[model samples]
Target chain A: MAEQPPESARTLIEVVPALGEVAPLRPGDPVRVVIRFPLGHYRVPLYLRGKTGTVERLVTPAIDNEEEGFGRNAGDRRYYYRIVFPMTEIWTDYAGPPHDNLRIEVFETWLESARHA
Target chain B: MHEHGPGESRPHDEITETGPPDYFDVLETALEELLTERNLIRPGEVRHQIDVLDSRTPALGAKVIARAWVDAEFRARLLADGRGTCEELGITFYDDTGLIVLENTATVHNLVVCTLCSCYPRPVLGLPPDWYKQKPYRARAVVEPRALLAEFGTIIPDEVEIRVTDSTSALRFLVLPRRPEGTDDFTEEQLAALVTRDAMIGVVPVTAGKDGSGA
Candidate 1:
């Protein structure tokens, strides 16, 4: 039943480093996964799109997985962050405790600084 | 698991030699011999590592959790860094994958899932369970963690928060289940026995039952 991942997920290849310099987001920074459904390779979950969360941990820079079809295993690198989002923020009918939340690693290319910066 | 190794002979052992053709057995033998001929991995080393992988189970993770429960300093080190801390306890990681230990407390209960793929802490918990990698579990774990936990016979009170962690990156997650009460006088080994695979995976909490079974 692992059917949630888009068809692009099956098309992803190896990792590749980006050729650029950028500041990595630190823990406690608010961020949101880019809300887009572009076809091809991407790691951001569909349910997490447009959702906001705080950076729980600053993971090391990782290779860009969005080769789509070309430049795979040779794309620019991006920093990864462990983003924590409340369940209430993810679903309208979240029935658990209000404090319940979700955490997932998101690439810099798939994320943007959220409001309340 | 009921199968025995080494000198123990099974009833079908004699017939197995001339029985059905196995693809993996031939492939593994060829690969191992070629690697050995190229001065790469030795056959003995390969056999030893096979044993290591086969022997690795949730017990290894359970032991680590038990140690964390008894020793504050070790627990702190485990929280700060999972790989180095496990290595400190003499647990060797076969690969470079990082292990991130998520602590469970009275306020928060942690659950782990790999929504995109079945990325798991194999070094600590061996292979991921079949259900963990399946599509339904992956799809629902994060969306309805409380419901999923309830399906697993775990009822988390409303006061306790549930933290669903999706292991989407290279680093894998292992839930450090809360230590059960009434075990203060229990030995470290006894505590380890009570810690089950489901508890370490955060689907359930560790219980203090004498009939400790299941991986």
Candidate 2:
């Protein structure tokens, strides 16, 4: 499910339903970015699809940017999670040391619970 | 090494007048003029907004960093709540976007990037450099940050972890670089002058010279 996006990427940003209000995710919880490339205005980078990471923080809930990108629903609030992925996990041939990592803010809809090793 | 002072025009600034206008440029002009014509926005509002944006510079962020370096209480407040702490210093937020200050320490170095879009801390730092908005830096910053940073002459030791922060949501990030050594007696203003835009962006580290300007 973590396959990379095709080179000839087409634009198909779908303004889907925002995730419903649920239990808040806490720091250190394992989560993976949902792997689905619809080609539209997605904030989740292609490199992170299906890759698991630990939650760094539960940032303040904000309006969903996917809908806002299409100038549609602007008031629908969605939680944004700060997830941190180690460089080794992100790139198979990560040249840097194992200590390097990347943290990014992903909306609730783009994430799913993952099993912790 | 040269700096562009306020009112000194850059090459891109004169694009509309000199270079051929692109599709987005035409769209921007049309929207701006239409807003004025329709009385939705005042004639001078656009220019005023531009002036406001231009007024914000890295110096504003530098002040925040220097203050944090010298003052412990302010540093705690800034780490806990970046937006509120910045507003306390009179740094205005023109948009709904929020700011997050990522502190760099001996063990960890922080770098900020917006992989999806060029979302930046514009209120504190005037504008992002052209290279920041390009695809190479955006893509490689997250994938191979060490190599990308090395090109900028910032060689992070293996012991020190490199953490790249991607600004995907409304939150914008600004790196608070560690104060260089031997500046213990330097005044706050002197320390502020040492802070650079690239350092704040996490591309470079701040260094002090032997000129005794600060000490």
Candidate 3:
């Protein structure tokens, strides 16, 4: 239960941002999540570390999770993408249908080009 | 603050069955007290926020879904802009979090989960159910969605592809379940009554009988 102050001075409806400024990693591009674990609060799930996935769509500009978790203002805006991973890729013994997939919203900083790996 | 080693259980065995206050509970109270003491936030702001959340329920989401089911134009608007559409129905999302409405089609099913934490669309669907925040639901929803859906009695056809969306703090998701059959003559109010929080969450589908009985 989080409460934000009323936006009396603001516009009635906030404009939703469109997909803007495609970076090196575009939708459908293969990418790998960084394996490093930083201290303090983080949004990247431990299970996704070192996993590769395809970018489904660009979601929004990255509002640094670490900064926000620490009660600080959002830092450098990076592109966040909706990445989809095959269940088999995430789990070695995935017993479900082969077509099943998992999609997660990941920030750019946590990803790297999967061309080499 | 004391930090427990990895995989170490909390030393609550010696305490009473009720045990001590949760560690995170103590931390949250301390943080709130500090913020209030410094005048950074009002004394009762936290309680006020909790009250605001408690005031919300699945009925609000049911109203939105009912409107969409009856009105094609409203359904289009809801698919395009979820927050704006909700606002049109007098439901304002005060927070900056963006709401995305996922539609369930005949061949496709959508399930939402937050593997990292419980990040739900509070404005529309209200607070999440207790099971949604648990680790089993969070971990299994993305990995074995069909099996998970079966546990909820939502048996999807083998041909239908199940799509799982992992929600985050920045973006929240609400599943726009397909309109149930045998309800063409039912009023919008009746349709709303048929809609449940679980239906909106995509774990179950809304069903109604011709006699307006519960499904």
Clashes of 1: 6
DockQ of each: 0.61, 0.63, 0.44
For the second chain, the TM-scores of the candidates in order are 0.80, 0.87, 0.84
Model 3, B1-215: lDDT tens per residue?
A: 23232223446553477767778756876787788788898866776677678767899999999999999999999988888899999987868887788899998788889988899999888899999999999988877788899999999887777778888658888889988887888889988999999988889999886566644
Q: How many residue pairs clash in each candidate?
A: 6, 3, 0
- CAPRI category for model 3: acceptable
Q: Model 3 clash pairs?
A: none
Decreasing lDDT order of the candidates: 2, 1, 3
Q: Write the per-residue lDDT of candidate 1 for residues A21-115, one digit (tens) a residue.
A: 35467788889888899676667888999999999987766676665335566445677789999999999898777799999988888778875
lDDT minimum window of 10 residues, candidate 1 chain B: B1-10
Model 3 residue B178 lDDT? 88
Tell how far residue B53 is off in model 2, in angstroms.
Answer: 0.5
Q: Give the poorly placed runs of model 2, Cα more than 4 Å off.
A: A1-19, B1-28
lDDT of 3 by residue, A67-115 (tens): 7777767445667788989878888887666666777888888999897
| Model 2 Cα lDDT, one tens digit per residue, B95-154 | 888888899999999999888879889999889999999999998899888889999999
lDDT of 3: 0.82
The parts of candidate 3 lying over 4 Å away from their true place are: A1-22, A115-117, B1-37
Candidate 2 is graded, for docking, as medium
Q: In CAPRI terms, where does candidate 1 land? A: medium
Task: Please report the candidate that would top TM-score against the real structure.
Answer: 2
